[model samples]
Target: MSQAPRRTVVVLAAGEGKRMKSATPKVLHSLLGRTLLGHVLVAAGAAEAEQTVVVVGHQAEQVREHLAEVAPAAVPVLQAVQNGTGHAVRIALEAVPEAAGTVVVLNGDVPLLRPETVASLIAAHESAARAATVLAAAVDDPSGLGRIVRDASGGLARIVEERDASAEEREIREINAGIYVFEAAALRAALGKLSTDNEQGEEYLTDVFGLLVEVGSPVGVFVAPDVEETLGANDRAQLAELRALLRDRVNTAWMRSGVSILDPATAWIDVTVTLEPDAVIDQNTQLKGASAVAAGAVIGPDTTLVDTSVGAGATVLRAHAVGAEIGPEAVVGPFSYLRPGTRLGRKSKIGGFVEAKNSELGEGAKVPHLSYVGDATVGAGANVGAGTIVANYDGVRKSRTVVGEAAFVGSDTVLIAPVEVGPGAYVAAGSVIAKDVPAGNLGVTRAQQRNVEGWTARRRPGSKSAAAAEVAERAAAGAGEVSEAE
Candidate 1:
């Protein structure tokens, strides 16, 4: 059996992206949970390149750090200056061996470029045995792009950048998509001949097409099936457009897989976000990093969840949760906030405006409207009333509260932690319990009421409150006289 060709990929990620107007590097700008360069790197993996080299510039240190996390297999080479695309690719190729075959060169800004597309390009290049093949796309607005100029035989003759092209050449709709596959030896030989003699005083990668044709080598073009796949973002606005396109693509796929996305345009689901069949995604919801919705789970008409998991048949609405686990049949929100470490059990309910963190609510437990349950655990069948507060922090240290099974915590009560509401205990409404309430006991802590005679009249003479008190006292005295007569 013959040995397969040694494939290599050189990813050019050296641009400063001045148009992005961000303190962070352009390739680091994120969308759908992945940075621009990260998406390209994933697609590049499709080619199964034996050797992968990433050229970094303009915040090279940051890019390298991120590469260490996302693409550890790839080698990082610094293009110390913002020379040009050609210069970047040349540096990357230099890091590889001389005999490396079927080298794929690409820009890191094109996030939508799919892996299958990369595979197809490599297949086309190798099967034709061409010196090079340019990935081309026919875009409606080809402005600011390098136009693809073909010869009489309909083969790629040359690539002309917009600045250097004549009016007729600029009118050509087919543009070079800035992705290419080159024969290793041929590319190395051509790079040495490149000069900064273009309109921009830089070594234009487009010039290499003309050089290859002069040597009587076959050069070809692979036009993209989807034009948007070859698109790259230059600014925030363009990035938004790309994100919308990606969102549509992702949501549509999920819908096809039996996930109901009620409003595809408004629902932004990350590419990494997973949803099982029969899961329903409502309008204006964003399911972000590490989020998964089990079958029969319904997520938001308005919600944002990150690193959270919702179990089967659970309902989460208008809630913002991060790093939380919601069990099956649990109901949350209509304005709830679940912070990190929150775990709700089956059939539990966290109602309107409730906020919980570092807490665990057992099965059948309930924390209804206007409550904050933090650093606490509510036992199964416990009912924590509306407006209840678990005071877990006391300035010096954070403590915990444990409400046992079948406990009844009244509305507007505060459970001062280091305390426990024992099983079957009843906490009176509007009470603040600082000590533990034992099983089956009624815990009530409130100051005894004392009504001082004529106090209101003395305190506020001639005031509306004094007038009302005087009338009440007169009516009481009259009633007393009638009782005496009887």
Candidate 2:
């Protein structure tokens, strides 16, 4: 029987990131709204790996939590205490069910790795049946990287880390990308035989290269296209640069996919965000965290969305939404904000200066101009008038405001917490509704108005006003004469 396809991806995420000086794990630090490991996992997924394992240390629990929450496919295996990359790989090996497949090792911090490059590495390992095939890159300054050295006959030799390399060997520009493809058995054996004799006195995985080469196990290098893919973030500045690069790559890809981005310079999008063809994203818009925009969706000049999915033909006009979902053909504000749990159905309109949180607006519902709806469910075709406030918060506890289908909530109406408006119910303007209104009923709570006529005139024309009039007359006389030519 033919050998089954072999493709296993091992992501090493055990680095301490001491330079970052952050409480968050290194791999968990975000790049373009995703953890570094998240980008690597996505790349592995794109590569169609048979299995993917993540080796985590230094805030392992936090890393595991993020993996569970954001990128579930990346199986987390904690390195109890990070000794080095070799130990990290061994810890990850324990999590692997079977080593029958070809193993591809990658660093979690190297997020810009392309699927093609990973595929090429796997192919190189399989074609030569080599014990190990390292993904290499030619860099201008490989000063601090492991130099890939060869023999006098130009054959593959060994890798020497910067500290271990002599001055002459350190001049070699070709460096290991920290990405490797290995025969599963050879990888396991080599990992088992690794030593910590280096300057750092830490088990260096690079040492395995020499051992594999000495044992007559074939080891080679597959030079990658982009050397920058090997770049890893160790500090805040590097993290920012990585984020910027990712933002550019993502936005450029989106624009090439037929999305019309008005200003690519100011647009920021997460790697996982999916934008359909012909979607229009304006300047200063941030599409973050798995948020997707459907075809023809128009996002704003100052719009910011987090963990939100906008449907086809939806127009989010200068709004900021977090953890919300907008249905097809929905129109949101030029200056509106949607908070967590805000869901709008098809053809719904949420206009300017409105804020909705933990509320569901049904199909064709309209909350136009200056409104606050929270902890509420507004039914289909309901019209929420301007300045409407769903008083869903009390001093002790918050409550819900349920407005039924086709209901009309007038301007400046405060539907106090725990109140409900039944179907077709109408709340009059300026009403402070403290109770629920039944279906088709009108809730109006305005006290009898005793109009005080001439109130403005009575309050005006005081001595202060007379003194001001006299001063105004004197100033008029002293005014410069205008020349009038006939």
Candidate 3:
């Protein structure tokens, strides 16, 4: 059996993207949670390229740092200055060995270019034994794009950039998509002959194809099946369009895999999110950053989950949670906020307008309505009533509040930490408890209620007695009206 050819991929990512008007490099901009370059690298890996090299220049260090984190397998080569695509490719070629069988060139900003498309291009180039292959597309409006020029025999002659093309050439509907595969030896030879003879004084990669054709080398063209797959964003608006396209693709895949997205148009799920089968996602829900939604869980109508995990059979409505783990069968929010380090136990309830941070709630625990529990732990079956606040921070330091099993924390109570409500203990409503309560005991700290008779009458000109008489009169009139109507 003949051994497979060694494949190398060169990604051109050094463009400043001045049109993007961003401080960050253009290829570093995020598309569906991954950087544009990241998507390109992923596709290159999928295409089974044995060696990959990235050419970086604008904000080179920053791009290098990011590549170190996401794609350490790929080598980074610096171009040092902004010249042209040809010059960038020339720099990238230096990193590849002379024995490399085939070389694939990719534009880093073209995130939608699929791996299968690339694989097909490689196979076509090798099978046809062509010196060069270009990925071409037939678009409706090819404005501002390079047109594919063919010679007398109808072979790809050259690619004429829009600025350099004549009026007739500009009318060509078939455009070069800026992706190519080249025989390694032919590519090296072409690079050595590149000249900055264009009007812009920059070496043109398109000139390489013309050179190949002049030498009687076969040049092939692979028309992309989908024109949109070859699109690259140069501005914010285009970036958003690409993002929408990518999001739709991702969402569609999830829907086909048995996840229920009520309104895919309004649901924004990142590429990193994982949703188990039968999970129901409501409108306006954004699941991002490695979030996992389990089966039978209902999330949103207006919720955002980042790096969070929702357990099976749970309901999270209109909540925003990050770095939190919600237990099975638990109910959180109609408007709850869960911050990092929060872990809600099985069958527990975190009701409306509640916020929890760095806290753990045991199974069956209930923090129902208008509460903030931070740096705290509530044991099994404990009830943290409405309007409860665990004051976990003091002037000098932060502390923890512990509520033992089966404890009853009354409404409007403040547990000032370093305090504990023991097992089976009861905390009275409106109390400010600073000390620990013994097991099975009640903790209460409130001023005794006193009745001040006639104080309202003395304090106000319109006294309480007059108010009561007015209420009685209204009641009598209502009763009379009801009797007459009957």
Candidate 4:
């Protein structure tokens, strides 16, 4: 048996996307943290194209840089002028190797195109020994799209652009999807015959299918099972719509795998985020940048986590955490901020209105309510009370506060940096401790209280003495009236 021919993919990303109204190329616009072109490249990889070529024009340098990072395997070719899709494909085909037997053309903006669709199109074209195969779809409203006109035998005859279609042809619901797979030699020959004779004065790739039909070469059509997969974004509104669709698709997959998203509409999880089975994601939450939620954990109601890790059984509510690790069974927030380098140990609690940065809280340690713990270490079972602030930064440099195991940091206490609270130490309420406290000792720094005799009567308004004198005067008048009556 003769060996099968190698497959090559041509991705057209050169359009300026003037409709997008962005200085950035349309293909570079992000969709779920990855660019639109990135998604297309991923699908190409899934299709297992032996060689991939990208045709870039508008903002070529920017696209090339991104391609280097995301799809290094693909080669980029420049189309120096603003031309139609046909010209772009011609430029791309020049880079394809001669040994290739099949070439697939793709649009960069259609991020939802599946690899299976590409494979199926190629399979249909090869199995039927057809010269070309076009992906077609039937949309409810086909305005502004090219109508697919089939021959009497139900094979593709030609694609009629909306502006060029006659009254009868305009009513066709089957439209061209702008994706195609072709026999390599047939496509090369048809490209030479293309002309800039259309309404836009640009060579249309749709013309190739017509040329194939005229030459008596079989042309096939593959109607996508889901029309949405063929959709491409041209403007901001369409971009947003496509993003929502992609999110729904990704979120639905996670839910099917045992993740619970309380409100799917409000939960936004990036493509890089991972949620273990049984994890509950609440409404209005955004999980981004490689964050992971362990099984049985509950996150959000209004929370954002970036590059963070939530352990099993942990609960994070109304919190914003970045580059932090939350331990198992830990409780964080109704409003808490955990910054970079923060590590909350198992069973620990970072309560509401607390902010922690570059700090390590040992197992069972509790920083409950209204505290700022930064550049510090709290030992196991240590209690950092409400209104406590670790003075970790001075005028010149940042320092560290170390609280030994079982230490009690009192409410409204300020532990100045470069200080240590030893094991079993008790820091009195309202103390400002700048020096280290010995083990099992009480650290009190507040000034002693002194009583001032009659201070309230002398200095305060509405004194008790004034009220007592008024009562005595009323009693004397009553007694005098009784004596007069007698």
The candidate that achieves the highest TM-score relative to the unseen native structure: 1
User: Model 3: runs farther than 4 Å from truth?
Assistant: 1-4, 97-99, 152-154, 462-486
Clash count for each candidate, listed in order shown: 0, 0, 0, 0
Give RMSD (Å) of candidate 2 vs. truth: 5.8
TM value for model 2: 0.85
Overlapping backbone residue pairs in candidate 2 total 0
TM-score, model 1 to reference? 0.94
TM-score of every model versus the real structure: 0.94, 0.85, 0.93, 0.88
TM-score, cand. 3: 0.93
Writing each residue's lDDT as its tens digit, candidate 3 over 206-278 gives: 8899999889999989999888889999999999999999989989999999999999999999888999999
Tell me model 4's lDDT, rounded to 2 decimals.
0.91
How far off is residue 477 in model 3, in Å? 20
Tens digit per residue, CA lDDT, model 4, 126-200:
899888989999999999999999889897889989988999999999999888889889998998899998789
For residues 1-486, could you state the per-residue lDDT of candidate 2 as single tens digits?
A: 986677778888877889999988888888786678877777676446777788877888888888888668777887888888888888788788585557888888888887777777777778888888888888998867888998887656998889999999989999988888788888888889988888887778877888898899988888887876777787899888877777788888888989999998899988768889989999999988879999999999899999999999999989999999999999999899999999999999999999999999999999999999999999999999999999887888999889999999999889998988999999999999999899999999988889875454466656676667667766765663332321
> Which model scores highest in lDDT?
1
CA lDDT scores, all candidates in order = 0.93, 0.86, 0.92, 0.91
Model 1: worst 10 consecutive residues (lDDT sum): 91-100
- Deviation (Å) of 62 in candidate 1: 1.5
Clashing pairs in 2: none
What TM-score would you give candidate 4 relative to the actual structure?
Answer: 0.88
